[model samples]
Target chain A: MFYVPVSSSGGDTVNTGAAITPAQYVQHHLEHLTLNLRTFRVGDLQEAQGFWVLNLDTFLVSLILGIGLVVFLRFVAVRMREVPGGLQNFVEIMVGFVDKSISEVYHGKSKLLAPMSLIIFMWVFLMNAMDLLPVDLLWRILDLFGVTYFKNVPTADPNVTFAMSLAVFFLIIFYNIKIKKFHLAKEMLTVPFGGYLFPLNLVFRLIEECVKPLSLALRLFGNMFAGELVFILIALLPWWGQGLPGGIWAIFHILVITLQAFIFMMLTVVYLSMAHDTH
Target chain B: MGINATLIGQFITFAILVWFTMKYVWPPITQAMHDREKKIAAGLEAAERSKRELEMAERKAMSIIRDAKQQATHIIDEASRHSVLLVEEAKQQAKEEGARMIELAQHEISREVTQAKEVLKTQLATLVVAGAEKVIQRHLDASAHMALLDELVAEI
Candidate 1:
């Protein structure tokens, strides 16, 4: 149900040079640059229906930004001064903020939490912040190079968000197993209801476990995707008309981006902490 | 878009990022932050220690000044007592010197008086002898005059 096409109803109007309808414009912006990697034949890549088709644009943008984030952070880390200034100060502040949040929420000593939280927060933030860029600007640039179907905001994609949340989900399960040991299976079959209701308890436990990553991924995905949609929708207006609403939405989106990133990081910490909790 | 291999690719990317960050990006920054925090705490502790040491030094200086003042007063008191003893000794020596001079002068005056008495006695005995000689020439003798002189000297 969550996999339904988010693009509005519109037929492809490319090569016609005719002004695209609002639906077609939104659809064009919604399309991802994809590559089909299936060994056997499947639906076309343009349809995004193949199970093995990769969203090239999503991976490219996310990979580039991820590398940029690491490089920038490494630069700051390498040259970090006792008296921090500029980029180093900014990076340190972010690092400190993430560390403090994880320490506060995640009481158990997992060496991975702080760094993981930092990566997710910063990566998600950078991806979301890409929405603030003028949507038409990148499209026009790509159009100049004879390219279309590029979505720059990686977090807007459910796949990317799901990938991150799934990673976190695995960590939660791993921690549960590590911390609870043999008791985890017992608790899953017993808790909230008694052992007598083991079957119902297992179902509920599965749902509970599924909900953590689902909510985490969907929350960020929904917010960024909506924000990106709004930008594309605003871009559909006359150039002059786009200014006021676009500017207003962009300003409001700053809050959305930061909040979504924070929510994602907070949930990751909370879930991992819950996993570490006994019974 | 439909779910695709991008999900797996993204998962790979995420894993790589997590691994890279955990290995390289996260540690140094956090370490720098921790190092800075420790440095700040050490600096604050040092400041507190120096402040305590300064207060102690001031207290020590005050005590030392008080001790020096007490020592100076003690030295002055001792000097005054020594001066008083020296004045008393000088006065006693002067009194003894004055008594000795007076006694020597009295003795000399008595000696002079005795000499003058002896000369007068000589002159009187000569006159008496001359008169006795004249008288003896008319009435008495020299032996009797000598016995009279001896008795007169013994009476003086």
Candidate 2:
């Protein structure tokens, strides 16, 4: 079952806009390009889909956001002075903050942690911050080119979110395997907590590993998706009435975007720090 | 409802972007940060060296000034000493010259006095002689009378 918001219904204020039911609008926004060409699976992964499945919109926005971040950082880095000025100062402050956090977590392995954490923080922050942009802005821009179905926030997509989380997860698992070796995995599984508690420990370990990606993906996806929905809902209001609430929400969302990005970045560093440690 | 095809495209785009960023963009950016730090350190070191050099030069200049003052004082002292010695030598030579001039004047005065005395004596003798000659002449007249006087004396 899908949840539909009340704002989407009877909210078409523009004369040029076509009338859309709440379900239609939400479905239109939620739909993704999938691998299953013959059988369309909603959330089931058992049905092995086609090989060339792709989410064109997700790729575009992710590429753009990533490139934008890279360029922006490069610009800042190029212009950075020991005595920083303007945006360079801001970038330095951010780098300093991240470096300090990394030092706190993996003080010994900061050589690896610093750069990794910085990229994760900056790249993901930019992705999350993209949600703050008016949802309709990109749609309107793309609508000119006859492309109507587009979601601006790449992090909202489970696939993209899961991919980022999985990258971290793999790194954790890889480090564990590399550090503990494969022999330890067998021992960890065979070790007895007591009599029947052995299975419990294994289950707990599995759950713990599973939860990393789920939580990482879900947290970012849920937040950005919710933020996007709020923007959509706000846009539905009459233009004159929309201005006040939209302006206020936008103002408030600036903090939300920056904070969420910072939190994601911090968590990423923390997770990586955890990965470098022996469980 | 059909799924949007663009979502997959965006995902691909984002993945490539992220990968490229990690590969290319990050290295140079980090390098740039390090390079900037090095430049700042170098600049600071250079400034410090320059300041130290300036201080050294100032000290050297002060030392030279001190040495010049000492030399100037020594020269003045030597000049004063030579002047004093010259004055003493001149005084001794002047005293000797004055003594020699006084002795020569005394000797000349004595000689003149002796000559004057001798000449006066000679003049006295000449006057006496002249008187005697005159008397003799008067007596010759008396010679005739003398014969008569002699005969008278003989008869006495």
Give the worst 10-residue stretch by lDDT in candidate 1 chain A. Answer: A1-10
- Give the lowest summed-lDDT range of ten residues in model 2 chain A: A1-10
Off by over 4 Å in 2: A1-53, A68-104, A108-116, A180-206, B1-15, B108-156
Candidate 2 residues A21-134, lDDT tens each?
Answer: 555665556544233434544222233244444555666667766777777877776565556688876776677787677677674443444655676677777777777777
Question: Candidate 2's interface RMSD, please?
Answer: 4.7
Q: Model 1, A1-279: lDDT tens per residue?
A: 011122222224443455555666777778877666753322233455657788888899999999999888888888979899999888988988998888887789888888889999999999998888888666567655545567889999999999999999999999999999999989998998999999999999999999999999999999989899988888777778989999999999999999999999999999999999977
Against the reference, the lDDT scores of all candidates come to 0.84, 0.64
TM-score of chain B of 1: 0.67
Q: RMSD for each model, in Å, please?
A: 5.5, 8.7
Per-residue lDDT for B95-126 in model 1, tens only? 99889999999999999999999988888878
Positional deviation of A228 in candidate 2, in angstroms?
1.2
